[model samples]
Target: MLRSGAGHPDAGQSEASTSRQLSPEEEAQRLYATLNEYLLLEHKAQPRLCLPNESENGEVTTGARDGAAHVLRCLKVWFDLPADVLINAISLFDRFLTKMKVRPCHVPCITVSCMNIALEQYAADTDTKRSISVEELVSISQSACTAGDVIRMSRVIVDKLSLVTGCRTSTVLDWLRLLRAMLRLHADQCAIVLPPSCQEEELVQLLEIVCCDAACVNTRTSELALVLLYYKLEQQLAESLAAAEESGTIPEHAYYLYDFARQLQLHCHMCDTTLAHARARVRHVLSRYERCEARRDQRQRLVWRLSERTLKVLRPTDRLTSLLPTIEEQHFAVDATPTRTRSGSESSENEETSDWPRSPVLPVYCDN
Candidate 1:
């Protein structure tokens, strides 16, 4: 739970005061830093969309690069992972192929496997509950993906990242952390779909490649992230559409496409569960901040009231002599009997005074 002012006195006072004191120049600098960080993440997460170089390489060679890039882009769109992540996955595939020497016919298999690995890692790390299982991974890899091809690619990616670097770099880790934060802000449910254990390494690899690429590093805004998301989903939809067409049951593929597309579309209205959850979490924190402010104000008012009452009660002690007359006045009434009558009655009054019942008696103290 978020702390209130009573719990974090300094945090409550200083932040509120500083927010008011911020100079225009200081505010501008803060905004610039935020926008700059967003742009860098955007650039790295999305891959270059150009067609593969065809002048020197044959159709098979060119086709392989194209297929891998397309698949990487597709996953980015479908899952809304950062562009850097997709780039990292593709680079992983490229590096693996570069070292092992695979043929063009193997392109689709490699591409699908790379995506599976990336998604697996994302889902596991973010969610405490709900993740894709090994059985599901195998099923997706064998059926929707090309005949168990991604299984080998998954192993290759894990081993290569482990053997090549031994550990992930600080830069990659930082980017992943930031991207996760951003996704949390937007509420990305890739955690449910991919899981942390399966995609952790792949996500790291994706971030590394994205950092290395100039186009990604130099990006100006989150446009890269957005475009990457759009293309990634489109690619998946196209592939599913093609497969359904091949099976002569395009309706089944349409159903798959519809489900995925529905998610992406829902995000447009800020309706997706992941994005909504992210928004709600932010609102929850802000609401706590507001509630703290309200409580502090109430406490201050109560304390001020108590202090005033204490002063009103104690202030008379300093002027006790001045207040004495008012106390006496409260106890007695003015003498209303005529002086002549009092004189005449005085002689007889000794007897009458003793017999008369005293009018309501007013007690008095002599002047102190």
Candidate 2:
């Protein structure tokens, strides 16, 4: 979340400080060059995941990814981790899933392990001790895996992907920060006052939400950032128009902002139609994630359907039947016959004769 405008002007700063370090032409050329460099880096670093179609495994893989994204988002917020860490974690998790075939049952363990890796990598850069231990992470995530399991999974991820987790990966937020700075520089060089740019915090949060979409794993970082940026711009414009009409006056900087958006498209070499489609897709997924989050918050209890194998592990004798009285015990209260001898050999013929039906009854007892 570091500002991309290190040497450039910051928001709310006077134009005097902005200076004339780069002319309009120079600024445009620089933006284009920077876009090219990011394009290459994004190609090399963006995560890839192929989500199964609806016909596959009841969409278990897709659900796992989307679920992991949301959980990681919450975990990031809880840990107060930087916005980029969530992206890095999710990217690593999805990439690992893409590299191998993972069962749905193991997805939670893998998700938590990926979060641990992301934290370790990010913690190194921050030079602080990790507040959450491996055991704590497992417990907090409600993962069935133990600390050792998470640790082992982390090693497996490192080995399978061969990715160096020592440094931060280029994420969508990085692209957005750079793009926003490019826009600001463009405005400064053109001497055209545009509306106050979108807030970085809001943009970062929105980008994080957008990443919850499983489809986003396939999206290039540059394009995803551009879509979010453009969506925010459009949203701002609409609000401005609404306020302007109410005030009976056209908003200042409207035309300038519109032109600036066009320049951004051109600088990024994105076709207008393609950009619009992407914006629509990003908005749709954002809304979907929001709705789901709302429902999640309103949930009164944990409601999940565990598979049969998991049920067995959790409920020995179904965890309920073992406590209940059998029909004979409930009705007759007869002393139970011992099924095992002192020698530990079976003493009840019925117990060893499971291969035969016992309910046909004796010929004398039945109406023949």
Please give the RMSD to the true structure for each candidate, in Å. 29.9, 11.2
Identify the leading candidate in terms of TM-score: 2
The TM-score, computed over Cα atoms with residue i paired to residue i, of candidate 1 is 0.30
Number of colliding residue pairs in model 2: 0
What is the lDDT, from 0 to 100, of the residue 307 in candidate 1?
Answer: 54
| lDDT against true structure, model 2 | 0.70
Q: What is the clash count for each candidate, in the order shown?
A: 29, 0
Candidate 1 lDDT at 182 equals 35
Residues 261-343, candidate 2, lDDT per residue (tens digit)? 67766766777776776777887888887797889967789769767666567654332321233456444336875564454
Q: Give candidate 1 regions above 4 Å deviation.
A: 1-52, 55-63, 76-87, 127-130, 133-149, 163-368
lDDT score, residue 229, model 1? Answer: 34
Scored by Cα lDDT, where does model 1 land? 0.44
Q: Score each candidate by Cα lDDT.
A: 0.44, 0.70
Q: What is the lDDT of residue 109 in candidate 2?
A: 90
Best by lDDT: 2
